[model samples]
Target: MTITARDIQLKQFKVKFRGFDVQEVDFFLDQLAEGFTNLEIDNRRMAESLKNAKIEIEELKAREEKLKRAYQELKKNLVSLKDEAQSPSNQNTSRMIITEAQRESERILAEARTRVERLNDDIQDLMKQKEMIDDHIRKAIELGKAILKNNDCPTNYSEDNDLKVKHLRQIP
Candidate 1:
């Protein structure tokens, strides 16, 4: 059973001929009741704070799971692209394309890993990191589509080449 401040205030004590002074005992009881009231208020505030913290933690966990799934999907796509590039029929035409794509993907993956490390260090920027990761995935998908569309991967690759991958800068 929970003892409340009002219960303490309403407590009674039988008085004898030489028992303790009534006024002094009542004054002490009042002080004790006030202390208990303050403690209860503080306890309620702390409980609310704990509840909010738990909600934030659950949200962060869900975001982390989403990022993990996206990373796994990206990894699977890269493996498929590598396998396709290695086929005998397309070896000659896809050599340069494969080389360039590998380089670009590696660079993108490294940058992503770096961003993930930063995100781990500071959770407050997770929303921005999610947006950035989505942008990277979109670019990677577009690059793969372009590579598949262009069957003639010429040896004379240059910055002006339509198949050249454009480097994207991070948004502040």
Candidate 2:
């Protein structure tokens, strides 16, 4: 169950003939409440960050897939153009076919150039995203480490989100 500040305030302790200092108990409780607050805030911040990272990662993946599809289409078009060049049906009007093929080839070349440029742009974007994600992850790890080191706070996370983030990092 989620504990609230009221729960902490309402906690009771048994009174002894000469019990421990009440001020010490109160101080410890205050520190515990502050730790819980910090933990909740950090957890929320980390979750939002991870969500954004995953979104960017998905976008990069989609870009890569689109580039691959474009490349495949270009390859298929090139093969068709090559096959037409080798065919012998228009032997009498070979000049016309050559001229037409040359024009089509030029068009294909231009299209391929455009596709290559787009693919390069996608690659560059993905690279920049990778660097950003890495930087963000490193900073988060550093912050988590500092919190654990400085305050002995719990390091448990809500899910295996880090595994997915690491998987994205591994994608070249």
RMSD of each: 32.5, 14.1
In the predicted model 2, the residue pairs found to clash are none
lDDT of 2 by residue, 2-109 (tens): 564445556666655444345645654566556555555655565565566566656656665665666566557656665665657644455565557557656655
Q: What TM-score fits each model? A: 0.48, 0.44
**Which regions in candidate 2 have their CA more than 4 angstroms from the true location?**
4-6, 83-172
Residue-wise lDDT of candidate 1 within 22-104, one digit each (tens)? 67557756766776676666556645655555566666666666666766676677577668878888776566665675676
The C-alpha local distance difference test score for the whole of candidate 1 amounts to 0.55
Q: Judge candidate 2 against the unseen true structure and give its global Cα lDDT, from 0 to 1.
A: 0.53
TM-score, candidate number 1: 0.48
Worst 10 residues of 1 by lDDT: 163-172
Deviation of model 1 at 167, angstroms: 78
* Model 2 alpha-carbon miss at residue 116, Å: 20
